[model samples]
Target: LGVRNLIQGLGEALPFADDTFDRVTMGYALRHVADLHALFAEYRRVLKPGGEVLLLEITRPERALPRALLKFYMKGVVPAVTRLFRHSSEAQELMRYYWDTIEQCVPPSTILAAMAEAGLHQAQRRIVLGIFSEYCGAEAGTDR
Candidate 1:
């Protein structure tokens, strides 16, 4: 858990040398990226040949019932609960923003296509619980 070399930088323009990392990972931040193509290109640039990329995202459910339920939980229940315990408007607003992003995010097909367009091989998404999406791809080469 002690990640000493963590550097805060933009996903579209990574602050690292080419082929510097064997793997790249992001969690619950895909919806915040301004450009999926640029982000995936940067990821590919930094990864060693055959290196893998994994992104964890909360995708909005496709069906109306599940989407409504998720929206109720994230946008309503979470904020309400946060206000009850913490009395912080910021926390409540953050949850609302989270739901908004998920609601407005592009579909899984578009994301996968972006990855493939960025030259990542075998791009695919795995869904869990109809809401959690795990996007994965590998740099185009044999493992070094």
Candidate 2:
């Protein structure tokens, strides 16, 4: 309900009442949340019956060709660009490490199953690209 409110008072712990929200959107915020399941649980707690959760995210490519391209970009192009930013190869390496860890660490199914465990009724995923996906789900007892 407060998607556009822009209120500064709410903490990482949301201020809204339980079961008050209809749509929970975390657009690419997954990169920062340390405990993924806790975030999903909080979303589950706040969303009303039939409420939906939408997550837009960047994922490692699953296809071989795309994966190879991504490796090239990650290992080559991104580092080249980063060098322009700070004249620091370590910065580029750090940035590369970030994406590398993201690819090695996060799992799409783990995320979806966490939603299901949180009582989201219908959880599904749509791959937007070889390197990205959108996870959409609804609260338990909700109609499609």
List all candidate RMSDs to the true structure.
2.1, 4.2
Q: Candidate 1: minimum summed lDDT over ten consecutive residues — where?
A: 135-144
lDDT of 2 by residue, 1-144 (tens): 658756552224777788889898977657666677777777877888878999888887777888888888887888889999889978988878867765674678888887788677678889876667799988874432
Candidate 2, superposed: residue stretches over 4 Å from native: 1-12, 85-94, 141-144
Per-residue lDDT, model 2, residue 84, is 96
lDDT of 1 by residue, 1-144 (tens): 899897788999888999999999999989989999999989999999889999999999999999999999999999999999989999989989989999998899999999999989999999999999999999987432
TM-score of each: 0.94, 0.75
Worst 10 residues of 2 by lDDT: 4-13
Supply the TM-score for candidate 1: 0.94
- Candidate 2 positional error at 123, Å: 0.4
